[model samples]
Target: MELTLPKKLNASQPITLETKGLVVIGVNGAGKSSFGKCLLDQYGSLAKKISGIHALFINNNVEEPISEEENEFSRLQSMITERLFMPRLSEYEKLILHLQSEEFEAAVNYKEACKVNPDLLPPVTKIDRIQSIWEKIFPHNRLVRKSGFIELASGSRDSDSYKAERMSDGEKLVFYLIGAVLCTPLNSLLIIEEPETLLHNSIKNLLWDEIEAMRPDCTYVYLTHDIDFAASRPDSKRIWIRSYDADTRIWDYELIESNESFPEEVYMEILGSRKPILFIEGTDTNSIDSRLYPLIFPDYMVKPMGGCQKVIETTKAFGQLKDFHNLESKGIVDRDRRTQGEITYLREQHIFVPNVAEVENLLMLEEVIKTVAHRLMKDPENVFNQVKENVIKLFEKDLESQVILHAKHLVRKKLETTVDRKITTVEQLAEHVEGIQQNIHVQDIYTNIKNEFSLYVETGDYKNILRVYNQKGMLPQSRLCNICGISNKESYLNLIISILKENKEDADAIRSAIKESLGI
Candidate 1:
């Protein structure tokens, strides 16, 4: 279970491959395959010391290459049949005789019996272990048990059986993996690379299910760059490898099981398009990153990172990935009470933090509100003031919740620094009640937070608040939602989108600002 490679390995700490699976991911040439090979070699040498330590390395390279002359179905079938029967070549005629007789069936039955239950008596019969596994992996594909051999029948085939060479790459790989698993020793390690190469999502799931059914019986070490696949296997142990020199070699590696920290290739794939990537925060329906940025900056691929920190990390990560070094990547995050110093530093890093409180705050503009009312066939003069009043009132009601959340965050931050250093023991927990009391002064924090929000909520001053919010940028959240109390039937953004019909000048102004941000 413990593998120690050469000093030059530059590998991470010794990895323990127990019942828990391991996923190895890195960029191309980042030592993924090399790491796997090194482990396999080490595993082979320690086979005697490590009990039940057989290993199977599965590269996605197709073993059976379709020959140029073997274009015909019969030719391909003959080539495959010859390869399958190669091991029994000495008993070729005898084996064929037995295959024609009932003895071959008896031998296969005994093999199945041993697979199903190793505790069964000698010369066992009446078992269907492989059949059961095959069913789980490819339920629709027919497994034809002919007198001569076992073959997989495609559902679309006109004949009774399918030529092995005729199957799709995915089908072939599944067949290869299942066959390899069946033949491997119990408690062996199965190393698979690039499982997503040709397999569809559904087939990949089925293949994984069959592998999982193997359980503690056989361990799996998957080398994959596919994020969705890794996300599906949450219980598995994950090791992310990184290199400094364009994946020429490994520089560092760490055990990062968190999906949030997943170094997915999709990032490079987007940047690989050679287009500017506008990385932004938020992934939900209400997010401007997901909903509106694409329309505004049509030239750039607007990627939605899970949060502000993720966007920052990803933007930096792109610089490290040398292949994508030329990519013009920019990130934008909400202005969440950041200090002037922090805001200045972030802008210098090409990461924009809008002047407004958030995207939502910038959208609460009088002109934008009037546009929405006009689109809805209401008198703009009559409804503008009402909408403005409602937005201001909503902010006032939301102020307490916001203050409470911020205070809680600060308290937790203070507690984290205070707890372990001063009050470590369980016995001191009761005596340290004063620590919590001293750190959390909710009333004082609430007063300051209320005063800060007062400028934004005061009546007749909403337009001025928007003006100040948009000081650095023009209509920063013009495409964002304004009204907070939107219903299931219609969102505030949807209303604004409708309003764009009556306000061509406003739409043009917003688009111009967006283009300026993109440097288009």
Candidate 2:
């Protein structure tokens, strides 16, 4: 069942969550669980416990309700070891709270004491009283022999026992998730942070599907940096967060449009640079994509690939000028999720631009270039010049032209959006002004990107598209030069043909290089 969020929640972009599930992902100190508590309190205390916390976590505090400072306090758990232990202790106390309050007073018979008994039972004075209190407070906890709560095993000797805290961290995390789920009603809201942490890789993938299948009435959310997690859900609404530096404060958040397709780009933007891209959907795939690209092209920047679909996304977002390219794992790719209506909206708004595969596709092209270069190396000037000329002519406008056109489109969009802002008050008008400034900043960035990369981009379109050199040598034995119609008098094609004709010893080297370049 859909737990419809308040109108204020809807004020942000209407993220389409088909099920009740939601995920919040960040580094250890990003306050993911705290955000969940705020959600629970706002909605009425659904999840009563957190599974695994890195440090001090405070919640359900009797005095001050959660506020910015409290959130900040909890966010520092990763920084301080003592802080991380807060959640576990807090949970232990909540579970045993009945031992102190209700039972003690009831056993002493507070009201009866004023009349007949005069004293509340000081502590667990009697075993029978202890058993009675445990039953009342932890009724759902199910004690077989009345000592501790039951942990149901799939198949056992019909026993009631708990190995709860004694399990591994990953197992405890699973229990924590289950406890969090149990605290809420069957039809309640549930949000989890990166639930995959401490989890085994074999189990990581199956976890979400298992969760989604159970209890159709429950709503859920999952925030993750894991590409498999992101790409796993076809229905997930990707919210790409980009940090913008503002003069007034420090970092700010903005969304990158169509982010699910470019997990690497979004990941790098959120995570600082220098961290290698390690995780991608279906990482073990074709050798060309996962292995060769990373090994041979060590000089090029390689991020973990997120299926074939992200290849297109990586290209469009980063404009494909960067040194690295994506390797397409043929088996797994994501399909774009635009309804006919949304596609129509984009076209009418002039948002349609040719999709160029900047990531994986370009990687293939680079391999082709290396192949061409090695094949002509022996012939020197004549063969190299010819190949270079053809490459230059072929890619003259493809990259540069596309980039410039998109820059103009962004400029037009920035203008249109500012004009559409609703300015009902001076403060609202000031916000519009601020928005305009950001738009202008984006415009400047676009312009600068266009200026810096235009030359290489323009020449790359045809030149960059690589093919296996069928001529074997730079020139074919059968065909005359298309430009000069010469079979003998010569061109770089002839030079390459001459080199190949004489060299039988280099065949093994050439073949190996081809495999390397093609990432076969």
Candidate 3:
């Protein structure tokens, strides 16, 4: 089934949805609810809209009317009101009746089959199916039949059972959702608004997967503002609602196509933001780049792209789309063991390679150390000297390994270029192999790297050492925390982050120092 969007959303030709699942996502006021309502209206009786704010009040004592017409009308009225009170209670009663009827039918069939086949297995009832699914979702809790009503049981004893109506809001929501879907007619379109509502992150995907598995005939339409939830359904067609014009009753929306080079979540996020993009290397939240880059570059929408290569690729991809998006893009990556030539090349591509080896090393910068020391009422000069001495002592002890690692990086980088060259003939391929072997002088490379590294160690140059050192635990090893009167590395990092957040002067000082060191 295809439902064309409102004509105003697309003047030339409105976008149409497929029978397969589709996720409609946007910010809070971007007409996601309106879009779902439109689809429900278009599809009419074939589509059922489940409100994000669906009523969770399930009263087992409520009785259905004797007249079928009255019951149907009541259900219609409740749906029109987004399933609030009377309809929800009536629906629960109907579900129980349906389950009871299925149970009776299964028993009758089993009795008849027993005479012919004593070993015949009994068919699973609707209640049994629900119980099985509930157990998987909530292993600690069990659903039990008590006094002709479904009750929640915490233990094996009957005394542990409680009325289903008394279940927590989240539990009630899950029960209502499962019952509604199972009760829905075959081949119906299920329009679920904010499906992630009241659902824990760990189980949101699992719940939807189980529901979809149970109802393979139904097409799911999830309307949500949660990008993470929207991205979770990789198979679903994604439509981003950009804006809604209340006066014109028109929406500004577009279908988001998959891009192999750019991630769907990152793309959706960038599309929603108005600021320039800053792709940094780290995980989305926990890493140092994620925590620190935003405070330093507040003008840009800082997105962590995990690794240095991804940061470079994403930045370049965004740059290519700049004409259409009207947004500038750049990337920041660790210095690592990149040589001056490599740094210069990356800088020309608008990818900023920092002076520090990695984001962790940023905390050990001279300016950052001094600023942190001053914040703790310690003498900046004395504290920094101690940090420098400790770092140099550590580097001297591990000098051979550090030099070898740097040489290996340079050799690998060089070989990458050589191996990428095209060779059309066997002679050329043989020549290429021989050239690589002849050019790669391990001892000479090691000697050069050692000499370069020794200069920093000999002069006790803390900044340059930070640029060359790839050790992640160097801060703790250097005992910078002790020198600055902080408790530990975590506390020191938190203090720096707090200073960046609350103290503008120190934040600027640190940012300026980093930018100057990086020459960005």
Candidate 4:
């Protein structure tokens, strides 16, 4: 059956959902639960809602068996108050009644067939089906059906059995889920809110896989904030709920589509962000770019996309997605030996190339150094000057090698673009290679880079040196931390971050200096 999404979710067009199911994911306060409630209301009798935080208490009171009518009524009422009341107890009772009825029918059928063929196997009841899955999830525990009640039995010993009500929260939750799913009406839409709640990572996927297999006729819609859980269901269509306007009862959301440029996890992270995305270069959260860029660009959500190429590719790919026009995206990659023409080209493509060779060098910026020094109550000018002298001295010591590396990088970048992929024949390839060999002047490139490097050192232009230098150890080597009375590079970085969070003026000054160097 096709389910059209609520109009407020996407007023521009109707989004139809297929029987394959859809996973609605978003950050907390994004109204995912509200969206689930809307679906329940829309589908009415065709849908059944299962809360993630269902009351796991199984009321094991030995009382009169509830009539079918009373059972149905209790189940319906529990659906509305399931978040608090012991709703699953009603379903557990229903499961027990269904199992007993099945057993009686099987016994009657067996008696009649005894004369013909007494070797027929007993039919599997709903509880038996649930037990099969339960055993797999909890290897040490077994489901025991005794005296018309389901109880948990420790391995190999019925004497160790305990009432279902006494089961641990996790165990009780699992049983409740199994019973609820088994008791659900045929072909109903099962809307599970935060299915990952109280579920261990190792078994969460397995439990859902088994449960879905048991009810192949039902369409499953999972509303959750857990990206990993959402990602585990590969076939489900993923929708990111951006926000909800309670006053207008409208939701701002987007469907997350698979892209060749990004993995599912990275794509979800990007789509899940509430702020405009700024893709930066870093491998992980511990990287300088990941930690520093977020504080510096407080207005945008800074995502570390590992290497420079990935950042550039992801940004361009994101921009091309016309559906995501509501979210603006940009990328920042290190300058690292890029010529002015290449830098200008990248800028035009919305990829900002900073004047600093790499992000680590940003810490060595003259203004940033002074900001930290002043914050520590040191002489900003003196500290900056000493740091500047140390950095220049270090750069001079490695001047020749730096020039060689820069020239090599530029040559490699140039040659990488010169290869003609369109050339098909060996003859054409030979001519292309010959043309590159004849025109390329390695000595000229080296001499030009060396001259530029010498000029920066001679002028003692701290900013330009940072722009051209690609030293990861520059900050520690300059002893700027020592000059400011900070213990080390890591501590110094932490201090900068703390200052940015607590001191607005210092943050703005640092931000301005970095932005100026980036020409942003």
Candidate 5:
């Protein structure tokens, strides 16, 4: 399973191609396709093992066998072209005739092969497998066979299904992939480059699932820069190929151990460039980290990750990548309810925790809130104090809900723990109860529960709860946005950005603070 790659393209470690599969992820030009070809080269020919309409071919044209020296782009370009130039139904007429005459059983198998998971779509016959995939891609439609051609139509068979040549690029790509999978023999290696190419994001997962059904026996190696798609397949081992040297002269690769998802552009920026990355916990869509961090540390590429743990995990994971040993990576996360010691542990690992409870809390600072209100043309005179008063009122109301919620959560958690302990003790007692007449340590389960409840009641302090709530004034991000009438984090940041545009002095202050904090 340990496959050593070529010396020029030095692998920092031997690749373990586990029976499950290998997923190759890299920035563009990081040699995802080249690595796949190298794997194909190392594994030798699939000619004897593979069958069907030629898994490696483009259309009916037999592709030039892969050469060791060929670059990734050339191979991908050929594949894309072949996928586009797939034959019409008329072209398959002769094959259909031959199947009907001599290879009837093979035809039957091909038909059955086309039939996929019922959840994929309504069931279709064998020849309609390609149609099934196509319809799924562009639904409420049907692909019907007519005189020597397949027509795409809206629902009814009376409407003509368009010819293959007339199909949309996505449809063409889907059909080609379906054919490639169905035609290929099980247990053969299928190398697909950027299956996301020309395909919509919505259909990406479904397409993979359908193809997987066609050839569960086939080992798939997907070469992609898509972090989301790659991360979605936790079943597969992900290999991240990156540049090793400072000048981007040498390329290196490593396997990502954790399920850390990053944007494709972030990978490109990290691997090839010298800029230090500011990794934050959350996706770009929802995280203010992407918007605010870039403004503060313009020199760094502010990349958003999945969550707090993911931020820490990725930082540690990347540190261990021998190829990227010199890669400067840092992580930032919300303080949340983490203790100072917990924050210190993360900081030691180069993960930064904001002083505020959360990133949203930072934006709600008096200056920040005032600036946002002024920019939105609110009463600038007492905006800060007005907002503070409103926020406090909101906080008091929120506390009412929080107290009940927290109390319920605590009671439930304690009850569950007590039940678990009781279950264990009773099971042990049952095991030995038959032999022993009396057990000195044994207490009635109901009595134990009553004692635990008394202890829980003694621990409850309303004064301490009130003091904590008042000290934090913690408004959930969603609740804060609701009060502001802001739909989301992005909108809130956008308002801040608008404010900064008009107030140069305030912007300068923010910049100064950023530079001071970063020691720039």
Candidate 6:
């Protein structure tokens, strides 16, 4: 029968396959496999004869199957010839030979014996047809490897063989991928309903590997509803089908581009806290985004909102609070005469493309630039660079202020000099400040962290503390000095613990210091 891809899409079917991979998605009865069968008939190598045995008919118990098909084929011939015309014995034997898989040769023979006046001769016509198709698909000389090695790949869930008769729907689907990849037919197509069904993540990778290997000759098309796997592809092309009316028999397809829609807001809220996000448009970004942000952006999150929708959400929820930053999107550049209102609005708000108009986060500052182009090009390193630079600026500003304060103190003590005394006074002030800095020893911080850690143990917030520690290994991975954000491991709290253990300082010292500091 002839089949064609209808101009009006019937339901989940590929209109085209411009890339190595294609996804056809819809609910059941969408005809996901029909497209595949059409391609198979057109491009798949034709056999002089084409057919396959249903596994239920194969007798693997005897270590062979030909023993059965041949017997069946021969018996049919005898029945046809009884007081009737006996066809060519060659045709009967040839048909029986069609069932001769090397492993099932015994069954093939058995089936052959059941027939009378069998046609044992085989024809090369079907073989020639297959060769013609293979000529286009296979190289001039496909490699001939020595056989007799057991080479079964790790089985997918579908390949599990509890029993052939009791196979599940999911298992049967997986069986197609397994058989198609293993068959290595030069020209064919493997069409499956849902590749994601019953597939574990680890084995899912194996299925894709098989698909890629078959791409040189075979074309695969499967339907899926897996938004998690679906959204991972930055440039995924989807044939989106929707119910046109309350009850329509037909499903139409549209080419969905990456720029069309956006991820939902809930995902932005959750993933926004954990990792930076790259803002793309989509429906299901949050739950999946939160799950993958840390894996993708280990350093800084590329938030999809970029304070666009997030800023708006913040404004709506916390407009009463003084700290709330408003969502200000810079729509487009005003080409003609600009006004003060436009300039003021532009100056106060982050300039983002107007396509995105959702708000999520209500906490952080919204630093808007005129365009999304600059932000999209930034790497994770650029984020860290900003942090490091800001930290240096903070420290330098504090350090210079402290030096000025010390210089003013010297001036009060009558150390003011018109010439060389300025330089000498600066040096003396630095020396005094250095002496005070050395007085803060870890024996102090450790005694301090010990008290704090002990209190944490009492309050049961220690579980939360342990969680933070586990997140970063204590050895060479910790950030804080276990006291302040200083040297926690080696010199500060670490050294104090060592000294106190050796010196046997009373733990009461911490309480005493605390009480004195409290002026109790």
Cα lDDT, model 5, residue 308: 86
lDDT of 1: 0.57
* After superposition, candidate 1 runs with Cα above 4 Å error: 5-20, 41-127, 151-168, 215-217, 244-252, 257-282, 285-287, 293-460, 463-520
Off by over 4 Å in 6: 1-5, 9-20, 27-100, 103-176, 231-237, 244-250, 259-520
The alpha-carbon deviation from the true structure for residue 127 of candidate 3, after best TM-score superposition, in angstroms, is 4.3
Off by over 4 Å in 2: 1-19, 25-49, 54-165, 243-520
- Tens digit per residue, CA lDDT, model 4, 1-520: 5777765554677678775678998899999988888889989999888864554434445355566667777865755786566444554445556776776777688778876887877667777888899889999988887765678888787457877767776776777688678878988898898899998999889999989988888889999988888889987888888789887778888778878786666767766675788999987898888888888888898988888999989888877874764678889998878889988998987899888887888888888988988889999999999999998999999999899988888889879888889999999999999999666799998898889889889999888888888889888898888778889999998988898887589999988888887787
In the range 30-82, model 2's lDDT, one tens digit per residue, is 44444555556656755433344431233444454555556665745533754
Candidate 2 lDDT score relative to the true structure? 0.42
Candidate 5 regions exceeding 4 Å error are 1-16, 40-44, 47-129, 132-139, 244-251, 259-275, 279-291, 301-325, 335-346, 356-361, 364-494, 499-505, 514-520
Maximum-TM-score candidate = 4
Estimate every model's Cα lDDT from 0 to 1: 0.57, 0.42, 0.81, 0.82, 0.58, 0.35
What is candidate 6's local distance difference test score? 0.35
Ranking by TM-score: 4, 3, 5, 1, 2, 6
Model 1, 466: alpha-carbon shift in Å? Answer: 4.6
Looking at model 5, which ten-residue stretch has the lowest summed lDDT?
Answer: 47-56
Global Cα lDDT for candidate 4: 0.82
Estimate the TM-score of every prediction.
Answer: 0.50, 0.38, 0.79, 0.83, 0.57, 0.31
lDDT of 5 at 234: 52
RMSD of each: 10.6, 19.2, 6.3, 6.0, 12.0, 21.8
Query: Which residue pairs show collisions in model 4?
Result: none
1-520, model 6: which lDDT tens digit per residue? 1123323434455344455345555444444444345445555463111112222133323333345447777866765884267433332233323422432554456467658536555343332332233222322312111132111211342332233224443333334344334354554444445556666664554555544553455444445545444444333345543322324423454444432123423232322243322342223544322332223223444343433344334322322221211222121121111223433554343222221111110000012110111223433344333433332333333433333433343333332221223445777767755655355443454454445444544454422232111111222232222212334333432332333244333222322332232122
* CA shift of 236, model 6, Å: 7.8
* Model 3 agreement with the true structure over 88-177: per-residue lDDT tens digits: 544545566677777777788899999999999888777777777777888788898754578898855554777787877677677767
* Residue 433 displacement (Å), model 5: 29
The lDDT ranking, best first, is 4, 3, 5, 1, 2, 6
* Candidate 6 lDDT trough over 10 residues, lowest sum: 356-365
